[model samples]
Target: MASREFLKILSSARLGDVLAQQKLAEAYLTGAYKTPIQPANALIWLEKSYFSVTNQELKDKQTSSNSTTEILTQIARIPLAQTFQSPAFGFGWTSFWQLAHTKAETQLHLAAKWQLANLLINPDHQEIQAQLMEFLKGKNISSSLEAIAGLDLKGLQKIAKQFLQELAETDSPFTSAAKELLIKLQPKNAALSSLWISWLDDKNEEALLQAAELGLTMARLTLGLRLAQLDGGDTKSNASLKKAAYWLELAAKDGDRDAWYALGEIYRRPQFSGYSAAESDRCFDRAADLGHAEAQLRKGANLWRKREKSDEKVRGLQASYWVWQAHQQGIAEAKELLGKILESCPDPQKNDWHELALQAEQAINHHVEHQLDEDWLLLCHRIVIANQFHFSKAELLLCEVGQLQHEHCVVVDIRWELPKILPRLIQIETIQQRRALLAAGKVFASSDLEIEGNLRQRRYRFDRVTHWLTTTFAKANKHQTNTELA
Candidate 1:
């Protein structure tokens, strides 16, 4: 049931109106104006509209070129009129006419071609397949595959297999999708499958290597992993490492995330691949970009570690972005790391503090429900420290502070009278304990030095404690300093 307006547009379209035909085609494609969903009708209208635009452009090109150029110059110099004079003088009329007389023909051609390919799904139609092949000759393979997938056609497995094989031979971003399709098409008793099975069952390394060389993606990754982890036969020898790297690099080129991550690990270990930090980071970045969660976490952690050593603000923000991405993807370890990073962040803006508090609350709730004892404890310490720095206002911070007070009350008392207690309190690994001891030391530093008879003994012990605490604070501050953005 087409609306009256749509009927009028279709009437105008049949009378050879290019705009009306294009509108009618859009209406059919979108089922607008109560039109039934008929892709065939859409394709027909699109083709008619495209040919009409092409005829008009050819007619315009046949006119005097000097006259057309002069008209374009005059149109470009004229500003918009204050009031409309005629429908022909409407806004954008000149530009629209120019575009339709020039570029619109090509655009319409491509649109019609895509719509036709999308509508034609009969694999038996040699004409349609030929048209598709012609259109896809120099186009992006991934986009072509996506258009084909939308057709949802049956009985085209052979054609699809051929396309996948061609894509697999190319070094395109769609290589992974092509490899996956190839694996799906592989027979259960294929030679590559048998070789992979043999290697899995009996550690037949040569069989796996042969299958890998035969373009089996999984076999390449498996053989690479096996070679990387090989023991007792010069495992870290240069030749062995180079061979492992070769296989891993091959798999990585075919868009295997695990292979990229494994290469990153190999390059990180100096004993394995001579320790190229830049190459390791690059591999980790590639894997992370390919949607590997572990790679994201590892990259984030390494960036944070490096930022500590270099005190670079850019690195800190980069670390936070990666860690936050991993956390959003539900990586548990990422949550704890992000919480600590946010807590130690100094002088963050209001919005940053708000986000930090929210993340802390979420981490606390998750760790409590899952009974992740170690993670919960670490987050608790981080929350308390964050509250000390005013980075967050989580209620769990108060609870942690109370627990620290109860556990270290005696140590706090001794720290005031005896400076030797500083080292013992600092030896405790908990962040809360160390922070409390440091606070108490500040209090002692501000007090009077009035002593009775044994001033020399007291001063000597205080000097030793002062020296140790100074060295420890210097080292900690060096590593834990806040990143200052310019």
Candidate 2:
């Protein structure tokens, strides 16, 4: 119910008032009074005030609260010359017509009347098409037709096409809205059309399953897809159909990549109770090419598991490729796995392996801080350092590195004392050069160095302490002198 004050405002608003027009437009646009203020009525009065003799300041009042560009465009398109003349102009011409085809219907009637009048006056069928063709010569009617091809009728289609051609370059959402409105106005086939749309807004698996059994293509596709994904050894009774394989195969053949992927997975990964690896690989291979990333990863992993060197090399490369693609697209696990593989590999570097290693480390840190996936943190640390240096080197310096950790340390026997002469052989260069040598498991070998001096008994401790100080002091002095010169 509107307040007495609102009703009083409306009564005053009807008498050619600009403030009233603005207020009424707001009320209608927002449903201010809970009184079902019709937009059509509000638009008519607002448009009237917009074009009439009124104070510029009052008439130009526009709100920024809501901006539906399509609605504004449609409102702007209405001709002011013939609007609100009388009921004869049309039945209730207003903003409500923007939501329906009535306004277009009225315009169509007018256009038809002009065409009919011209035809009656001239009465030449050949001349009519020739004149129409001449009028539309430069106009690209095909593009216009394509835009409104969704509309049902020839007349509205023609008009919409022409309108689109005129506004081809304009930024408007009206074409979509107009096309939707045209669909609403279309005549329907009452029988088959009743069940044309299938909605599933709630969780009712049984209903979906039953529908699928009854031969609804969508339902069959859904259920067959799901059944194909069940772990290989479930009870036979729950298999849904003895022809389960048949329907799933059919769904896959029908361009359902998910179904194809699912079918491939089933055939490839059958349990002791159920498929063979060879069968599963074939399915996975097909699905992978059909743009299924999971299938590609699965196929690659499966191929690597077979221990066939040629296949292992191919699959590892492909697995890395597909996983990297997925990782770049924001899949976190793919990113982590790719990082690990890149770090572990010894030969040709296909990507920035170190960057990926850091990515894995940072991601693991984030996860660990949130207590989300603590396992990845340790794994990330191990892989990153291992990739930066040799495995033994990384393991030995694992304590020095802040983020990476191992589950446990195992001592491996060395046959003889490490050559202390090796450090003297290569002059200590960059900090990174020293780090690289140390990480390659040199620390473990260096532990055996014999200190033949006054510090002989505490040789192990003395040598390590001396080495640490010399490396640290040397790097610090180099950096300091460079800084001082600068």
Which model scores highest in TM-score?
A: 1
Which candidate leads the pack in lDDT?
1
Q: Clashing residue pairs in candidate 2, if any? A: 268-280, 270-275, 393-439, 393-441
Query: On residues 7-105, what C-alpha lDDT tens digit does candidate 2 reach at each position?
Result: 866887788665666566567656776656455565665665554433343433353212232233334433322233332122223232232333443
lDDT per residue (tens digit) for residues 109-213 in model 1: 222222222223323344544544334333322233433433322433344454456556666555555555455445556887888888889989789888887
Candidate 2 stretches with Cα past 4 Å from truth are 1-199, 202-218, 226-241, 268-274, 311-315, 326-337, 344-486
For candidate 1, give the lDDT of residue 294. Answer: 85
User: After superposition on all CA atoms, how large is the RMSD of candidate 2?
Assistant: 24.7
lDDT values for all models: 0.53, 0.43
- Supply candidate 1's per-residue lDDT for 183: 55
Give, for candidate 1, the lowest lDDT window spanning 10 residues.
406-415
